[model samples]
Target chain A: MNPAVPTWAGVAASAALVLLAVAVAWHGRLRLARDIAIAATRAGVQLAAVGAVLLLVFQHTGLVGASGWLALMVLVAGQVAARRARGLPRALPIATAAIAAGAAATLGALLALGVIAAQARVVIPVGGMVVSGAMQATALVLIRLRDEARTARPAIEARLSLGLPATDAFAPYLRTTLRTALIPAVDSTKTVGLISLPGAMTGLILAGVDPFTAIRYQIVVMYMLLAAAALASLTAGRLAEHALFDDAHRLRPLTTEPRRERV
Target chain B: MAPDELFALDQVTVRRGRAVLLDEVTCRLSAGVCTALMGPSGAGKSTLLRLLNRLEEPTAGQVRLHGRPLADGDVLALRRRVGLVGQQPVLLTDHVPDELRVGRPDLAEGQARTLLEQVGLPAAMLTRQTAGLSGGEAQRLCLARALAVGPEVLLLDEPTSALDAASAKAVEQTVRRLVAAGLTVILASHNIAQARRIADEVLVLRAGRPVAHGAAADIDYLKEES
Candidate 1:
């Protein structure tokens, strides 16, 4: 083990730290505080459930089981993303494309480059991380794009009247808005070493990995995140633009549908 | 449903959390004519205009365009056919003329210049930042944007209420020209004199209800009541 974490107690302490987070979440009285508490409790249950499933999958090594596990991850991620985007375009397809693309590319690269064998242990965590990152990027991009689309409605209508196609009409605003969404990933990648060390690289170093190997892994992960975020943002942005326009190239009215009143 | 009747609100009523914003309001707006919706600040004139374009759906009534229900029709097509210009003149672009032609980024810059010119703005404003535009320039730009869509019906909510006399006159002249070009105009304004100068028909609204509706030239009684 590396000098930073030479014993198993460090991992144990990390696990215990989650309890403090739960306590803090519960003690707070804000609107989202209860939600945070619920989310933390749910996360604990989910992690345990996932661990039980993974324990069986690792031992069996069957294709059906492995694919099923991945599918569950994708489905859960997509559903969460869609719920976050309450009214914007269909979030499932965007999340699916983003997660599939990001996971496949990153996992494939890691295996081909011989970073680790195509074993269950290495593949599952790394794939999950890539998918999760892509999901976050997709959500941010979709929300930002939707808001920008509304803000740019007048400009869009102006172009439509000027005889432009729906796609062509939203291109200018869409371009800038999508670019803005990708900035976080870009800045994180650019300033990785000079500003702050990334979590994965630091964890690996603490776990006794060689400095050079850790750095290479970090570099690859950073590039993968960039690729994933850019692809996801672009896909989600285009999807949003299409969803908001009609066949005759007119902008659709935004909905303000009231929540169903319970008797 | 006449070709001339570009927009018509038929027994439209709007409620906000159980409070009536507009109640059973009926009005017909025609082509090649300016109709001023004269009312106090809180009257439903702006809300009524929003209903005409399906910007806000009515709680219990329907708006019609060409004799068909506004809700039943495609919203995008309707909005494209009817353009809106508000008091604030929200120009959703930093690149001025370029942003104005967003969907058709390939559209010639000169076309945008022509639109600015038509709205009483100098062609030089084509390159200026939209944020830098004066209130009058911004208002004209909004009109230019509305006109850019080739809308048969135009909804103007206090188009000149925020401008100086010179700018107001310029905007009023543009409205007259638009009417002359066969575009339908529905304007909501507090300026009675400006209304008389520009409107062919006038509808007086009080407390979200229409009290009087008729030709603008027959407004002597309305003036007496004021």
Candidate 2:
């Protein structure tokens, strides 16, 4: 083999991806373009750092390092969820609780079923997918819950005065609000196969895996995602209810709290 | 016991965010009588009524219903007996009269229809979607809803503020009828004519405090302002 294709091919591919990202950024406003440029640079550096570490860790350390990688994924996921809901005072705890409950439960079930083995290579990627899905669900549910509580406060108070218990009085609105938040996950689940084959399934097939094996993996992943999304949304919804109401059952002003400014 | 002394407030004071929304606001609402609150904007007119219902907790005073202290244990029980209506009448997006009456399975279909008629709404409107009801019709529906709970004291908070002249007159007539039927009505409004026409007593609030409160006909200050 005259000269095996340069190991730098991976770097060259990433550089090309960066160029395309910059071109897209150029079409936006200057502020957005600057943000995009900074984000792309950060992402590239972080990925490269992880890639180097992974190369050494996988070669030397065994299963223990792999567990570290899985835990790292969860930590990153929690941070992203918190960042997304930074404006809400109750976001951090709600986000972490949601992501942890959702990812762990769904992932545990899948691993036990042998859909994904206990191997870190398989476990980490699937867990990352499930956790990220939960994070998005948590963010959406919290935003909707906060907004609906404010907009419909009068109605809630009216129901309360009608001799309905606080929770029962809020049940109608909570149902509507939670259902609205879950619509995205519901829609995605409904349109999954017909709209497009997901990346993991497509990639597995491209790598010479049998069609039936790819289909099995895709089905398992999709169901786990739905499971994760539902759990996260429900947990976030419950937390939001607590955060919005005081111990006396009076509504707390969601907008009154001073939010920390992003750096 | 006379219905005239149905509800009483003993030096109720409430603070909201460093502002004294109600200070030493003592008043009594009589059964089968219409009491109107008259004051300029930002006067504690609305806040005073909210206190009677225990919707807002008092900072340094107590509210008594039927001569008993209003406390956490009695709040829900009292609230069920008190019907409070606000300016913008809100109805849930779904549900017609039937759904609202589910808990009180004893509520007859005829009673629901009669409620609509009492509020001057067509019985046909009850079957219609709440989304399609006009401001006037919806206010009437809200009144009907409040009546469904069988309240003894009706707290009216600018109940006609969002209605047209015709709708306002309709709602006022409804209130008049309710008052005639032995319900204690506490009406909060800024309109002098409204107070004079229906109120046996008047309470004026200013700067989160009651500046003037007494019989409507005897208050010369209202004449000066109106």
Candidate 3:
């Protein structure tokens, strides 16, 4: 089923919304107008490129092409997450593993249960959602773990001096970061239908599907996102914890360590 | 090289970014002796104490504990034998008993009370929260927590600097008792008089360099300051 086509005029009209945002930022002296403009331009260009690629894959590729698309998305998502996880060693690899694990667990369960169709059109969109959610959770977990590890260095060292293993010494901070990382997912999920119509449900309804049917899909999406977030946050938090401490069970301060600062 | 040598820092050096916190300094701290690390603010007293417990690894050289390389054995076990009370009191848990049980979770109430008493805190302190403690009380609590693990060597980083005169004296007495009982102490202090009183040996550091290290009484600067 085809949705209403947007002409260039319509695209320009929609792009004008970014100017409004830029105007407000300029008025407030927020110094974000340039960033906002750049981000909007990048988003438009990237989405256009992704759309062209997806169309090509849909026409000429099978399950392999679809899987390749998902893998590519996972890698890109990992890089995005790693950008936010400054001062963490092996952040790129760790983020990739976490995002991959979360996405696999989420999509695997849905696929096994026959909840989502195995078509490329279905898998790519659902995988994108799962990977995006996982990326966000992973990045949040890493950032929180890094910041809390620095601030709580004294307490962590105190635990280490007590002869506690590195994992045991870092357990409290890991728990805190995990909880903090999962907060957004939990809050948004709880308030989904009440506060806002999430992207999936909006898309489904706009695709001429029944509202009640769209509601079913939205619930599944919410559940999958929750699962992805928990899995990703735990993986990233645990991995980052291991990175922060040495074999001597002593804390190596994240910022102080001679690491390549992501500037 | 003596059989009684507890911690031997063979040219141990620590650098943070562009600053050299501890220069090439070789010193052997004997077992069952109280060794004070005396220095000015940035003279690396804390850095030296941390080295003994293997808290901060040196940028260069080696640290040998009990005649073995510090990295030879399990670090957790090493830390248990060599405990550390940092400059500030950072009790793991809010309550006294729980804080004591942080590393040793199987700690009994009686044992907790005994550790408290050993640190000059009353047994009644077991019921108190760490949040309400005074500077001296908190430092003593940190000491009690360290003692709870039954460490052979205790590292104290300015353990009494934050306390008032009376509280400092109380901590000093506790240290004397521990030393008499054959516990090794590597203390970091700015107070020269305090060092002379408590330390059997003193290693004077000036700008991270070892200026002098000998028996506390024989150290001319320490004697002169006294």
Candidate 4:
């Protein structure tokens, strides 16, 4: 049986469901109705733009153009992640290096092993997935590491007073932050088939691929995400740990103002 | 400044933006002496203690150890020799023994027990969880952990401020014993009685400047503050 291609009518129907949800939220006095509406519209526009761009690159680009596109994705991801980790010195460079290294290493290995075809069609999508996963993990690790270091100042200073190096003093907090950062990816992998079908597998199956083939692709994607997230979190944590302290090994006082308390 | 001074601050000043936390204060701490920094709240007593280990840097002038500038040496090595116990106890691990051994993992269990005994805690408390410890017990545990580094100088910042009267006495006695063991101590205390009881000399601070520095009995400024 041939897979049915989604037409403009199908897209409109999906959007109508979002409008209905927004109406329900508005009736319940949920202030999030506006946010829901705006987010749905934004997601639709962004996805359409991405789809067009990917088609152009897949049809016309060689390896050089594909790599350039992948680099652009990584750059944008790094900027977003760095903004989330605002107030950290050198956060942008740190996030960029970590995400790039993680995505490059994982994609390089997959390509070298001949597990995935070395074409723009496979590399761009797979590389985009790896980069986004690392971006998320890096952002969480940076933010958590900074927050933990600030709140745990007394403990860190106590350790430093006993002659422990900054790296050794921050070991426990780093471990906690890395674990927190990677748990999301780990959990999704664990619950993939049981809780819900992931996007890759569902997409492949809907595109007329056999179920077993989709499952195999989904498994590889899950493992690759875990590897990328782990590497990203660890690298980001290590770099952020140094930023928390000064050359004298003293905790640098956080310059950012405390977040306003929610009423 | 005496040639035998262990620590000497010459016109040391610390500024946080526009406000000066510590003004141009000069003092000398002689070797093997217990010098108490007596001040009211926010008078820079804790800031002065922090300077000894380079936890906080002075904005102006200099702090010298053994007649050499503190900035001249490796800070980690300097902190190892000059240990600090903060106003509140902070432990990294759940168990008392692990907290004690955190700084010195090579420390033997028996040696840790001996340190606990010196701090007036029972050796059996070593196995107890740090979360279950009383405030005083936690403070003493911090002290024991500081001692694990074998520091030549110890800085205590309101070490007994959170303790009950009896707990305060235990900590005070432990500190006295450490001083007698030839460990130089710089203690920051708001309690005049505690300072009088333990200090050989007193440096009185008011609004970040030293108003008096002399023998504890001779310094009448503390009496006025009281």
Top candidate (TM-score): 4
- Fnat, model 2, is 0.30
Which consecutive 10 residues in model 2 chain A have the weakest lDDT in total? A1-10
Docking class of 2: acceptable
Candidate order by TM-score, highest to lowest? 4, 3, 2, 1
**TM-scores of all models?**
0.72, 0.87, 0.91, 0.94
lDDT of 3 at A148: 79
User: What tens-digit string does per-residue lDDT give for candidate 1 at A5-59?
Assistant: 5355665566556667656756673445555557766876887788888888888
Which regions in candidate 4 have their CA more than 4 angstroms from the true location?
A1-3, A258-263, B1-3
Q: What C-alpha lDDT, on a 0 to 100 scale, does residue B145 get in candidate 2?
A: 83
Q: Is the docking of candidate 1 incorrect, acceptable, medium or high quality?
A: incorrect
Q: Which digits, one per residue and each the tens of the lDDT, describe model 1 over residues B1-226?
A: 6677756777878887757889888777776789999888878888887777665678877777778887787666777687777776766668677556643344577788777777778888776888887888788887887776667888898998889998899899999988887888999998888887899988888777888887888866347646
Put down candidate 3 lDDT per residue, B26-136, tens digits, no spaces. 888999999998889999998888887788889999999878998787888888999999887787788988988887889999899888888888999888988998888
- Kindly list the per-residue Cα lDDT of model 4 for residues A152-261, writing each as its tens digit: 98999999999998999889899888999999999999899999998889989888889999999999999999999998888888788777788999988787753532
lDDT of 3 at A7: 74
State the lDDT at A35 in candidate 4: 88
Give stretches of model 2 more than 4 Å off. Answer: A1-6, A20-36, A52-89, A206-208, A247-249, A257-263, B1-4, B93-106
Q: What does candidate 3's lDDT look like per residue over A194-229, in tens digits?
A: 999999999878878899999999999999999999
Preferred candidate (TM-score higher): 1 or 4: 4
Model 1: fraction of native contacts: 0.20
**Residue A259 alpha-carbon offset, candidate 2, angstroms:** 8.5
DockQ list for all candidates: 0.19, 0.41, 0.83, 0.85
Candidate 2 lDDT over A150-232, as tens digits, reads 77888877776665666766777678766876787778778987998887788788777887889888888888898998988
> Model 3: how far is B40 from its true place, Å?
2.2
